[model samples]
Target: MKNADNSRRAFVRFLAGSPLFLAAGIDGKSLHRLITGSTRDQGEAFDLIDQVSQDRQISSPGEALDIFDFEPVAKAKIPPAHWGYLITGTDDDGTIKANRDGYAKWSLRPRRLVDWSHLDTSATLLGHKYDTPIVICPLGSQKAFHSEGELAVARAAKAKNHLQVLSTVATTSIEDVIAARGAPVWWQLYHTSDWNQTRAMIKRAEAAGAPAVVFTVDLIGGSNRETMFREAMNDTRTCTNCHSGGQPRPGVSGRVDDRDNRRKPAFANPAPGAPIPEAGPPTWDYVKRIRDTTSMKVFVKGILTPEDAELAIQHGASGIFVSNHGGRADNSLRATVECLPDIVKQARGRLVIELDGGVRRGTDIFKALALGANAVGIGRPYIWGLGSFGQEGVEAVMMILRKELEIVMKQCGTTSVRGISPAYLASR
Candidate 1:
């Protein structure tokens, strides 16, 4: 068995260096099965790539072996400061690690002698069915990562038929994103503290044919993203171009006054010397008001507790997006996955339960669904793809995750998204 494992590793290493490996777009999980065999009796770790070299650089989206491959390429292509913004989490960044670490607590128990073909990954959100259970979490200011930014992401989401939630601080306007996506997209609200501005934004989104408005509640107060501060020190570009109010300094998170109007089109053209419109904590009354103001379904994002989840349902929220703001919000050190079960129970199917944060694999999505998540959202993974190779990169990342989910469904003898349940999982 040891000899066979060594031989498989040797062959994978050879494949890593070959031209075909860079061009063939082979599945990374399949390679893992080949290298680790049916079991890991010796507990050897799965290394997707044991050898890294310039010669192995992927020139196209098809060349990427997994979702992780896009990160390094995105780093190579994006500016250091912008990359820092994308990578940073609050405080010590423990929450980010926790989000990924939380997945290790659960293990899938495969059932044998069952047909696994003809798998259906389609999922329904708010009476609408999408091609995949995976949805895109709203990431503001995509133009910072790529020239086309949200426009590119919109096109990619349209091509793959994935649901997209556009950020209030998105570089592109709601009208443009809808036009680019070729369909109505969900709008994530993060505008001014004033109710009028908020109402106007929601109305604009409605005018654009948005069916839902995701009100993110976690980022009311700002966070200390130390990593972004550190990376900004290395950026010699004229910060005033985008950050006209002032450049970001060490120990100081960028304020709304410091940002360029072009970066946040949602708050574009405010009165001169007027106070900047920023995200603030929304009360239950505020949520009810939002519900009363719009015909669109209201999804309350960033609830991490059963109590809060219950409150969302009480306030007429159509859904609960269980997230820790990708660990970029306050460092709560609680993973969205860890918070999912209780919230799901509290919701009791009263509202749709979706989650985002540290979803890097199809297995992660499967775990969330098993824990009672109706669907899951991904933030950084798709952004890495967008930053690395533009629209094609985004499409590739979604396709890779869809394929991975399908493979896991087959291996676990599950035939459909709704068919996945807690019975298929055990605590590790």
Candidate 2:
């Protein structure tokens, strides 16, 4: 076994060196000849390469130059409101741009000769193993996008052997989500002004078998998502779930319900009202409350500062998710990717660090891992996939990303995700 492994690695290294071997023009017999001539473990390597070559054809562009043109097509197909929510970052969206720009500052230094035949992109987090280092980031009210909503996403994640983080504002209930997927799910918690509600939600998530609690720290107050609001206004109907109990009534200062509901004509909007009862900002004490409530692993999202990262660890957070709320919270903040290295350094070994934002390619996944992210959360792309083709769309998106990651690993001369490190990147 050891010798076979070593030979596989050597053959992979040889493949990595020969650019001609990767060309589309190379016939299978010619490639077989090249491999057999180049390495002692030619037979085994040839078989493995043949499998990869077949799979590679699925992603390879034949008559087209732009393989990634599907992204824009998918983007255009999404509803205007959903598209706005997915694409726009908070405030001025500076942080969103920063996320993409940060990737440009780093370059991958592909190794010429290294054994990468047994590459695995699988990752284990919070004691749970996943097929890939990618997880579906929690996005709220997916039901608005499709009928399957969170359930569809959960099914897709289950099929791909990936993790799904259930948002506090998910269209489906936690129990139903678990029932549909029958897999451990991560819960994204939004801190509410009502402590009792927060505690209740946490207890419910635990009872439902959610493996982790990801506390979203940035959206204490509602964001100025003008596009979503505008789209909502244009629509003739409102989502019953969004207007259900717990949400503040429109133009009211506190929660409203069916018993106290009053009908105000769309044309007769003249009542002056106090500010709505939005969720108050959460402090470290809230983190403590979360820690006390659940034995599940805790991860704090929306962390952009080393100071905040330290505070999160000190407050008993098991992990930190570097995010800028997908550029929806505060546009002035640095993109989550830009903040990852520092947070990873500050937390040291005290916490596991993961990140999300502006990730569009498998190379982006590789880049984040190389820059100290234990894993990455994909938000909009999956949604686009969901909106476009429902479960099949989601499956297609996952397949694309996984294939991309495999190809990237093959090209970079590293087979295992663990082998991806800062050494593979240039500090441009």
Candidate 2 least-lDDT 10 residues: 259-268
| Candidate 2 backbone clash number | 5
Model 1 per-residue lDDT tens digits across residues 175-265: 9999999988999987455566667778888988999999988877778898777677878898777676556665455533234543577
Global fold similarity of model 2 (TM-score): 0.74
lDDT of each: 0.83, 0.71
lDDT of prediction 2:
0.71
TM-score per candidate, in order? 0.84, 0.74
Extract clashing residue pairs from model 2: 9-115, 89-327, 90-327, 90-328, 119-415
In candidate 2, stretches whose alpha carbon ends up further than 4 angstroms from where it belongs are 1-78, 230-280
Deviation from native of the Cα of residue 244 in model 2, angstroms: 6.5
Query: Best lDDT goes to which candidate?
Result: 1
Candidate 1 segments exceeding 4 Å error = 1-56, 250-263, 269-281
